[model samples]
Target chain A: MQAGTQKSVLIIDDEEDFAHTLAERLSLRNLAVQVACSGAEGLAFMEQNLPDALLLDMRMPAMSGIEVLRTVRQKYGMLPVLIITGHCSQEDHDRAQELGVQGYHSKPLDFKELFEQLVEVLHQK
Target chain B: MTDKHFMAKNLASSTHELQNILAIIKESSCLVEDVLQINGKPRMKHGDKLYHSLEVIGEQVDRAKVLLRALNSFAHAVSDGAQTCDLVETGKQTAQLVERFVRLKEHALQVVVENGSAHIACPPEEVIEALHSLIIQAITACTPKAPVLLRLGAQQNGQALAIIEVAGAAWNPEEMEQLAAKAGGSVVLAPGVCTVQFPCAASL
Candidate 1:
């Protein structure tokens, strides 16, 4: 990331501890970060605040990542969304690809790589 | 397409949950390292030890991830009744799936495949089970701490083959014959050496 450019990132995941811990790590890198423990909360947060990039977990209670992606695209067109998942089925993968998310990454991620990707995505805008 | 085993569903579900848990453990470790790297005093006494401990945690998490992935692959092996799989890769998966069992016996497994992969059209679960049975038999017959080696290759005529060799394993031709009959492949058993053929191998 460029000096003096603070990228804001929102992570929408059902895993509470994981979401927050990741948020904390990212925040330490000079980025404004927030975590929503569910798709609904993430949407509510989005209604008030929009981050530069969003990381959405694939499987969630009540609403899946694809469903959230659909709603996000409809409500806020062209928001850069990245898909994060533990294990994704082919059908969900195909759907996520169709939705035009910026990237799809698996869990147990390499933190440095993910940060690099976040930087790249932020730079694109 | 039918679920071959009632246990597979639970195994698959459990592995997914474990993967997520492992991911959190890793991220938390990374967070610790991040803090240390950024703000730790230059002369902190325990800094190096803490960094080494965090590295160990990261390595173990990576190791667990590999095992979990192998378990997940094993659980889903029975998804398609007629699915074709590469013999060499399947051999490696079988080795990974039996990690705990080998550890309990104070043993290890090594898979060897020369050059390109070999494909077999047999049912995936059956192939896995057959290779597993051979490995278990070899482990039991071998001396302590001996590595159970699975050699995957092809015959001169292009048929795929698998051989299990554990030094000092008791020779048992009868059991190998029966397994061979079921798989429509030939078997040759000798002391610490067993070779099984897969007649339905698509290619090498």
Candidate 2:
């Protein structure tokens, strides 16, 4: 993906408001954005469609981000996955890093830095 | 784990959800700002005030998020059965949890934490509960509008202590000593300072 070119990003977070807001922000930045409110929904969406990059949350009720990441990696290898979480333990962080997450960030997010990473991740793809 | 443990877990999890709500509010407000900026700020009437209001909302959301995060961390402080914990972080969490309550009574609670960890091995929840109670008592005893200070530090004997200072208030050393003793600690109240020295890890 070329820099400044339109890219599609999927944000998987259980918080509807956060996902919508992030989607709006990404869209404003000129990137196509899709939001899934749960890990299961995100996985279901990924089964049929692959975005340029993914933004995933760490903690969820039924299915966790780690579980989603594991499944995504096995099913769709090398797709850029960025872990965005508000509550994450160091153990989870190390595990996600080992799982080949492109980047990791904590909330409240730094949208500027997140956008730059999104662009970079899309470029990598 | 006891019922208290279950309650702490619930509180921590709730904070996570609360944070998401705050994030959404912040983002929605940001979207409004984005629209205002894209439409050209100078062209719209009352655009400046509207933008300023959005900014204020955003600031409050950010502030709420920080408090929620601190509360969340504090809730999880009890996750582990008695273990070593940083006194500074514990003091901050204790203050954050009850800040609103203090403010409701028209008083301020200022928590000042040192950089280094003053590690203490004990039931963090119990210690926090005891210290929090002592602070509240001290705050009640203090004059109106006086700020209560919760300061954490390491003692000469490598023990951890939380100093709850209430300006212009006289504390009952004997009562505070009893409170601290119940939590496996000791207290020294002088004029306006209530020092709570936690039990050593070895004792625990």
Candidate 3:
């Protein structure tokens, strides 16, 4: 993907507001962003669409971020995945890193940093 | 099993939800700011005011995050029966959670740590509750806008003392004694001050 070119990004989190606002922000930055409110919905979307990058939340109602990441790593090993969390522990960080996350971030995020990371991952992918 | 545990569980869940809510507000406000910057706001009326409003929203979200963090810590205070706790950190956390309470009563609450880290052995939830109750009572009884000072100090013989001083409020010796006993500490009273002393877990 090149700068100023269209890129697809998928965000998986149960937080509707965060997902939508993040999508809007990414769209403003010229990326086509889609959101899934649950891990099941996220996996469903991935079957039909191949996003350039992924933003995943660790805590969800069904199929946790780790589970989603595991499935993604198994099916789409080369995809760039970034972990987002609110109540992250050391165990979560180590686990995500072990499973090959591109980056890790905590909630109340710095959007500029996220945008930079997103672009960097898209470029790498 | 206990009510405190139940309340802690509820608070933990609720604060997690609240964090999600704050994340949304944060991103929405950021989106507004992004739009303004991308469009250059040259032709839009009230663009400056709108940007300022978004800034205010972002600031309030930050403030809410702090309160939620303090509340979450308070919620987890009941997770253990009795443990070694940092007196300074715990007092600061308690003060942050009830800062609003003091403000709403038109009184001021200030937390001061005169000594370095002091470790105490106690049920953290009970200590927090006792501090909250005493502060609220003092704030309510004191003259409007008077300051209530919460000071933490380390003592000899491996003890830590927390002093609650209300400038214009009278002391309640009997109630203070009960509160101190319930919190696993002893109380000392001055004209408008109540002090609770706890044994340090490490020293014990």
What's the TM-score of chain A alone for every prediction?
0.95, 0.94, 0.95
Interface RMS for model 3? 1.2
Residue lDDT tens for model 3, B120-185:
887777778777777887776766688889998657667798888887787677887787788788
Candidate 2 lDDT over B79-121, as tens digits, reads 5454656677777777877788799878888877744666667
Superior by lDDT: candidate 1 or candidate 2: 1
Clashing pairs in 1: none
Listed models, DockQ each: 0.67, 0.54, 0.57
lDDT of 1 at A85: 81
Global CA lDDT computed for model 1: 0.81
- Candidates' lDDT values, in order? 0.81, 0.80, 0.82
Off by over 4 Å in 3: A1-12, A23-56, A65-83, A88-106, A110-125, B79-84, B113-119, B140-144, B152-156, B191-193
Candidate 2 lDDT, A17-123, residue by residue in tens: 78888898788778889999999999899888898899999998899999999898899887899988888875788888888999987677766678788788787
Off by over 4 Å in 1: A47-50, A70-81, A98-104, B1-5, B41-48, B77-89, B103-107, B112-120, B142-148, B151-171, B177-204
lDDT of 2 at B153: 66
Tell me, by DockQ, which candidate is best.
1
Best by TM-score: 2
Off by over 4 Å in 2: A1-8, A40-52, A72-80, A89-94, A97-113, A116-125, B79-84, B104-107, B199-204
